[model samples]
Target chain A: MSQFFTAAVLTSTVAAGIALATPFLLAALGETLGQRSGVINLGVDGIMLLAAFATYYVALRTDDVLLAILAGMGTGLLMGVVTAAVSVTLKAEQGISGIGVYLFGLGFSDLLFQKLVGTPLPITTPPQVGIPLLDQIPVLGGMFFDQSPLVYLAFLLVPVVAFVLNHTTYGLKIRAAGENPAAADSLGVSVARIRWSTVLLGCTFAGLAGASLLLYDGIFQVNLTQSEGFIAVALVYFGAWRPSGVMAGSLLYGLVGAIILTWKSLGIIPLSGSDLAATAPAVITVLALLFVARRFRQPAALGKPYEREA
Target chain B: MQRPVHRRALPALLAVAALVAAACGSSSSPAPVSSAAAPASVAPAASSSVTPAPAATAPASAAAAASGATSATTLKVALVAPSAVNDLAFTQSMVEALNSIKARYNLQVAISDNQFVVSTAANVIRSYASQGYNLVIAHGSQYGSTLQQLAPQFPNVSFAWGTAGSTFNQPNIFAYQANSNEGGYVQGAMAAMLSTSKVLGVIGPIAVGDAKLYVDGFCAGAKSVDPTISCIPVYTGSFSDVSLFATAAKTFVSNKADVLTGTAQAVVGAIGVARADNLPWFGTQWTQVSLAPHNVVSSQIYNWAPILEQIITEIRGGKLGGATYTVTLGNGGETIQFNSGFNLPANVKAKADELIKGITDGLVNVPQ
Candidate 1:
């Protein structure tokens, strides 16, 4: 424990935490937007898996990182469209439909991967783009600025997402559709359109999250996101549908996960109980959610489909 | 003015289903639910946790069985592995061994890869047994209980499984194991010798079977090389999640580990990290030099042919299982194949050769 407290160890752990947070922050930001618009796509993990595989396959063929990321976003866009159509236009149960989308994404991605790419191969990852002189600033630059472009992209989207959700006419319409769909419809604002937009954007972000995770390791395996998407869904709740809150939740999870990993590496955690220690991030996040649950109220019209009256 | 939402949306949902089904149709691997290939009685073992590989019938072997060209000489074998055939770990080792013996024995082989779900794997095992496959290998320890139930039902078919030495005292049930500890011992000794910082990191996938044996042997061997050497291990608690293994590797690298090694399929992720850090890596189960050509020191390849061939011959000799077989450094079941790519010092290479010989000759104890 004492050795774990060293400055070097702390810096390394925090640096890892920021890198680990990229996927969660990216996914949760999108989810936050979706939830803010009264939509909850439970298949974020599935979307990530599908997108991750697409990104991997594209990278394998083209050796182009940017193209691979686009491929991921495209896969996510398709999945998002599926999710939006099922939940919005089709008026299927959002929870069940989202799960259906997830199952399809999960199974389909795996099927495609096995069929197309039999073995897991390494691909070109997004090289870390350090912010020059800022990166040389002792521990801070390494902790925050010296990360993959995907990480920076994820963090940069927070402010953009916050602006879209809190300011502007589009943001107001989204809040209205989520909070009082009947009123929004009465005002001639298309609830379905707003939701479709949010779901599309959010799911696209989920796709970016998958690409980021792939870039993190530069490899793809079955279910490579490994419930990180599900964790992103949880983070939407942990964040209470705010971009800032989602960022904090993601960082907390990442930090806790990094600490546990650091402990395992340092042999501070016993071999027998290392598994239990590994569960710390999920456990702590869940506990935090429980504690934070009472303070945050969901949108009143959330999860209720708006069927316009004749 | 527009079409009804439910009426219009029905086609969209059907289209989605059709697209998914179409992709699955063109899949090279077997659809997740392999009960499609098995008889009607094989329950739908469609598990969501992991997808099973295709029920691939080895082309030459299948042709031989179809023609009955050499009825007396042909041996039909079915393999039900817990992971991908190309996992570079347990399943791949067995598949390679089976492939090695396939031509020599005129064996017809059928494979059901990625049957990680025990219940699903059990159904595949039973389907193979009922189909009159001469030998069915349920290749995971998790399938032990399933074998106990199914092996009794098929008295004529010989069932084999391992990385374990338990045959459940049932006739027609064969258990085989790899004394992976021996090779692991050699790997750990080599890693310790090669490591400059004397801090070696080990990654394990959930501490089960050979994964546990290999890591335990590694630590013991490392300690033997230098009593004061540090060989701490991190168990990633998953076999499929590459990111977890990568995270474990990054942590190891950050902690000043100059040498790295681990077990199971996802260890590729760790090997990637090792390659990035330019650290020496020891591998097991199958040759991982392809994953990290320059970084890999040597691999402990599980040549299951020696033990598996012994079981096949015993079955031919009218001894239908109820025995355990083990492959070791002594029995030629496991071997150390060093990578020609790495610039290994002559002294270190000689020491590794000596360690292998010492273990093969019972001079070294790979104990925890």
Candidate 2:
């Protein structure tokens, strides 16, 4: 424990936490957008898994990072389109349709992987780039600025998401749709369009997150996302459906996870105690949710499909 | 949407997430490592006296029996495994060993694969015992306690389990271990020489059972090569969580580890990092070249056939159980299979061979 407090260990652990938080932040921020626009994608995990596999395959075949990223986002966008078709246009129950998407993503990705890449193979990873002067800072810059570009993008999107949700006219329309779809529709805000747009964006972010997982080590396997998509979904509630809150929740999770991993590595936490400690993040999430659940309100029209008056 | 009013929406979402997480967690094995398992085949009947068990009765064993040349004296063997039979790691070693002895011993094998949950596994173990299977093998050390309880209840039945050297003082129990340290020590000695930075990373499932011994031996071996060599071991506390394994590997790389090695099936994740970083990886449990052909230096292959052969011979000699067997390099139970594709330096290979010979001939001691 004393050694864990040393600057070297602390910085490295914190740095690890930040790196680990990238995928969750991206995915959760996407969830925040969808939920604020009267949509919830339960199949986020599925979208991630499918995109992860696609990202790995493309990277393996092309060795083009941009093309691989686009391919992954394309997969997510395609899945998002299908999800919108079911939940937005067809008015299927959002929860059930999301599960269907998740199942599809889970099964089809593995099937494709086995059919295409029978064994594990490595791909070219995106190069790590450090911010010029920020990386030069003694310890802080190294922890915060030195990472894959995806990490910077993920963190930068937190504020971008907040601005879009809190300030833009489109953001107002999104808020209206989630709070009262009938009113948003009556006001000619096009609830369907707003919901469609948000869900697509949410899923594309999920795709980016998935692609980054592959980009991390250039490896893709069965269940690559490991259901991180679902955790992101839950994080939406943890953040009170706000972008900043979601970012906080993601970092909290990552930090807690990193701490545990470090402690185990340092032998501060015994192997027997590690399992119990591993559950800390979820336990913390639940407690935090329970504490905040009563304070913040979910969008009134969230998870409901709207049909305009004929 | 309003049906779950604002007050309850959070709880509702939590419930949905919980359900999704539960679904993911309930997988029989940890990951897709077992996706390549051979279709369960039945033993062939060698004589008119051989009768296959009904498919509805014990399907897996029935298939094994149907595929074998089963005779009247054939032994009914059941394997209770925590993962898929072809997981390419621990369970695969035992399955391969069992397959090797099928012809000589006339064993009718049944496998209950992916028994990770102890309660469910206990039920399957009980099922095998009640079916009067001549031999029941609980292949995970996690099942030791349950086996100890079950072994006494089924006194007439013979049982075996391992990567452990304990029979729980039960006369009807057989225990086995790979003494994996011998091979791990050799791998570590080679890794130390291979490293230019003199820093090494190890990914472990948990520090217990065979995992602890192998890691301890590895650290000792590296230090023996050069006392100043830095070899760090990190346990992800899971045998199947691939993401955690990857994270551990990244941490090591960030801390300047030049070479990597790990145990368990999930080590594929670490191997990926090693491949991406172009670092050599020493693998254990099985030959992992298929995962990272270029990165894998070599692997410590656990060949349990000889030990299985010994146990079978002993059992056939009127010994029900009460034996603990350790597979050693000298005993022909473990082999260091170097990857042919890897461009290892001549001196490194020679050093590895020298280390192997030393351990085999009992000239070099592996730290316990």
lDDT of 1: 0.80
**DockQ of every candidate:** 0.46, 0.19
Runs of candidate 1 with Cα error greater than 4 angstroms are B1-16, B19-74
Task: Please report, in order, the local distance difference test score of every candidate based on alpha carbons.
Answer: 0.80, 0.78
User: By DockQ, who's the top model here?
Assistant: 1
Best by lDDT: 1
Which portions of model 2 show Cα errors greater than 4 Å? Answer: A1-12, A89-100, A132-134, A263-277, A283-287, A305-310, B1-88, B91-139, B143-161, B165-175, B193-198, B227-229, B307-325, B340-351, B363-365
What tier of docking accuracy does candidate 1 attain? acceptable
lDDT of 1 at A270: 89
Q: For model 1 chain A, where is the 10-residue window of minimal lDDT? A: A92-101
**lDDT digits (tens) for residues A1-310 of candidate 1:** 9999876787788888888888999999988888888898888988999999999999999999999999999988988998888788777667767766776777777778777988767776666789989988887877787888888888899899889878889999989988988888999999999999999998999999998898788777766787899899998889888898999999999988888888888888888897778778888999999988789999877876667766
Residue by residue across A1-310, what tens digits does model 2's lDDT show? 7878766677778888888888889889988899999898999998998899889999889898999999999998998888777777666678877896786777677667756876566677877798999988877877888889999999999999999989999999999999998888788899989999999999999999888877875677666776789999988898999888898889988888888877766667775786677677778877887887789999988887776765
